[model samples]
Structures are given as structure tokens and as C-alpha cells.
Target: MKQKIRDILAKHGGLPTPVDQLADDADLYAAGLSSFASVQVMLGIEDAFDVEFPDNRKSFQSIDAITKAVSGLVGSTEAAE
Candidate 1:
């Protein structure tokens, strides 16, 4: 799951530093993740994982947070067994 999330970040993060180089808890805003890029990343994550993000945007703060939110959505009780 983390690897897939990393792949999404790598493809859409648009950071000055490579996504591979950033720590999971890295401050993505400080690393150059603009609001526009965050929207792109969110769309990419939804497409990749088949999970819709919540209406809130706070979970887009970092790769770790995004991964956790995606995992929960994808693993929800509403999901198929």
C-alpha cells in the first residue's frame, strides 16, 4: 500500500525534491507541493486506489496521511468482502 502511495506521490507530487527522497512524514508544503499539485495527487490517488477522498483537505498534508486515509477508505466495511 505504501509502495503504491509512493508511486502516486512520485507521479504527481511535483516537489523540488524527488518523492523517493522525501521522508514519509516530510512537510510536503515546505518541499514545494502547491495546492494545485495536491489536487492532482488527490485525483491520482483516487484513480489508483478506487477510493474517494473525504470532503476535507487536511489529510492531503503528507504521503503518510494520504496513505492512511486511502487505506481506510479502501478497507471500509462498505467495501466488498
Candidate 2:
């Protein structure tokens, strides 16, 4: 799931730094993740995982946060499966 999220970020995050270089808890916005890019990333994640993020859940600040959110939506650890 982490790798999947990283792939999505790499494709759509628009960050100057590589996604792998950023820690799971790193602040993506500080790492150059733009709002527009975040939306793209979110869309990519949703498409990849076939899960929709709830309208009230807006915590995509880092890889760890995203992993948790995806895991919650997926309801298991096999999210990448």
C-alpha cells in the first residue's frame, strides 16, 4: 500500500523531491506538493485502489496518513493486493 501510494505521488504529486526520499510522516506540502497536484494524486489513488475517500476525510498530508486512510477504506492490510 505504501508503494502504491508512492507510485501515485510520483506520478501526480508534482513534488521537486523524489517520493521515496520523503519519510512516511513527512509533510508533503512542505516537500512541494501543490493543492492541484494533491487532487491529482488523490484521484490516482482512488483509481488504483478502487476506493473513494469520504467527503469529510481530508487528511492526505503524508504517506503514513494516506496509508492509514486507504487501509481504513480497504478494511484490511491487503490493500495493494
lDDT tens digits by residue: candidate 2, 6-64: 99999999899999899999999889988889889889988998999875335688898
**Model 2 regions lying over 4 Å from their true place:** 56-58, 77-81
Per-model root-mean-square deviation over C-alphas: 3.3, 1.8
Writing each residue's lDDT as its tens digit, candidate 1 over 1-81 gives 777777887788788898888898888888898898888888998898788887767787777787678868888553332
Backbone N/Cα/C clashes per model:
0, 0
Count of clashing pairs, candidate 2: 0
lDDT of 2: 0.87
Could you tell me how far off, in angstroms, the CA of residue 63 lies in candidate 2 after the best superposition?
0.1
**Which candidate wins on lDDT?**
2
